[model samples]
Target: MNRFLRTLCVLVMLAVVAPALAATDVEAVKQRVAKVDVLRGEFTQEKQVAGFKNPLRSQGRFVLAQDHGVIWTTLKPFPSEVVVTRDRILSRQSDGSSRVELDGRQQPAMRSVNAIMFALMSGDAQALSAQFTVKVEVLPGNGWKMQLTPRSAMLGKVFAQLTLSGDRYVREVQINEANQDVTRIQFAGMSDTPTTLSTDEGRRFE
Candidate 1:
């Protein structure tokens, strides 16, 4: 083929391939996040109130199971653990006391947390779409970023947005919520499959 013709053909091919590749990457990101079952990691949480003079900082370990729930345990700057399940929230303090908040039966904020947990566990894009305008962007070096903005007024008041970033190995979930609260969690060491929490652990939040 002529040089010009060959170059033209290559360009046409790239034009078609590029968009398909981009769409595939977007789907891959969704799939990658959906497949995560159990996630255990260390995290740094920073909270800024609307009128606070300083941001509160804490270090913690996070445990999440797709079926059972999420346990956020803060070990530094005050020890506490928040266990979340389908039914309720169990918050335990370093003093060995616990408070339980019922699921849909509780306050608005608790219900919101339950909704978030359900969405995370189900990986239901439709459910999430109702509350968040989500976009997935693949970054260089095989990394990805999923950004979510609140679609509802209530969600907006509670959670401003969330930006999650991670690579091919395991996904890192970073949550940026209302009032400048940020949770940066990286999942480095993971099991081959998602694990299920015991009945007791799952009911700890009840």
Candidate 2:
């Protein structure tokens, strides 16, 4: 697959797993993520594909708005942006040219992907449980980890497993694909302050 398609697949994998956690632990995570109406963070992603001597790496900043959806901007390796909402997926190049845009009304898969992204990021247990069989582990210091196995045979053909770890927000996401490729993403410098998105920043979603 090309770089952009590969990256897109990785994004979809962000919510690929839904494991079982204690009810209290699950509620705690849901509550923690619920406090944020908007979230901004920096991320580093590494993909280890079989037969590649070195892993592909990229760095980016992301914005998640409760109603506006997600704006992910990649700054390293190459500049690109992906804006995903309930109704559409917009991809743009560094030159401010549109690369691809998918409307959910025309493409039902886009809607499904968008929903999965939101559910995964927001820690919505009900939505996740609909897709994957999940197992969650409580860690020391109020942190938690989760492992997800695909409940659908179709999903199992594409992914082997997915794991997520975090405290108040998702700190890491790991995807093990059926092809033996693995992608790991680490998020840092997260902020959920009301001022996190300025007027200019907010316009990116438009």
Candidate 3:
């Protein structure tokens, strides 16, 4: 074949193959996520504002176990923590004040965290779909972004949408709420960390 013709054929082949390769990668990521037992990482939450001259922000790390549940422990701008366990939710402030929500029915914020964690751990699209419109997209470097938009009038009252970024392992999450408030969290080195809920860690939250 002529050089120009050969080059043209190669380009056409790549154009068709690229998308299929991406889809395969996305499916593989989903499969790996479904079987994940634990995930741990450092995180930072950046809250943004447009109208206000100042913006609010926070930082944290998280440990998530599929069966045991989630922990969001902020380490910056003051130390604080939030835990969502199988039975209850716990929040401890920097000033030593603590709040507990049992059976997932105490605070709206707790409920929101629980809902998002459930969707992430269970890989249940329907759970999120009940509240948010879900769009799964292929991200750069074989990663995935699951964007969620609130469907319920009640839910939209608190937040507008949420975006979860990850690969075969979850790497970051952003919860974009109403009032121009945005919480962006980036997870680092999750796969290497152990996320088992030991007796000592469990007691600390309790």
Highest-scoring model, TM-score: 2
CA lDDT of every candidate: 0.53, 0.69, 0.53
- 40-132: candidate 2 lDDT, tens digit per residue: 788899989889989999898887776677778889999988877778777889667767876778865546655765666565756767778
Name the best candidate (by lDDT): 2
Clashing pairs in 2: 18-134, 19-134, 19-135, 20-134, 20-135, 20-136
Which parts of model 2 are misplaced by more than 4 Å? 1-6, 12-25, 31-34, 121-124
Q: Which of candidates 1 and 2 reaches a greater TM-score? A: 2
At residue 162, what lDDT does model 3 achieve?
Answer: 64
Of candidate 1, the 10-residue stretch with the lowest lDDT total is 11-20
Please give the lDDT score at residue 177 for candidate 3. Answer: 57
Q: At residue 187, what lDDT does model 3 achieve?
A: 56
Candidate 1: Cα lDDT at 167: 63
Report RMSD (Å) for each prediction in the order shown: 15.4, 3.7, 15.0
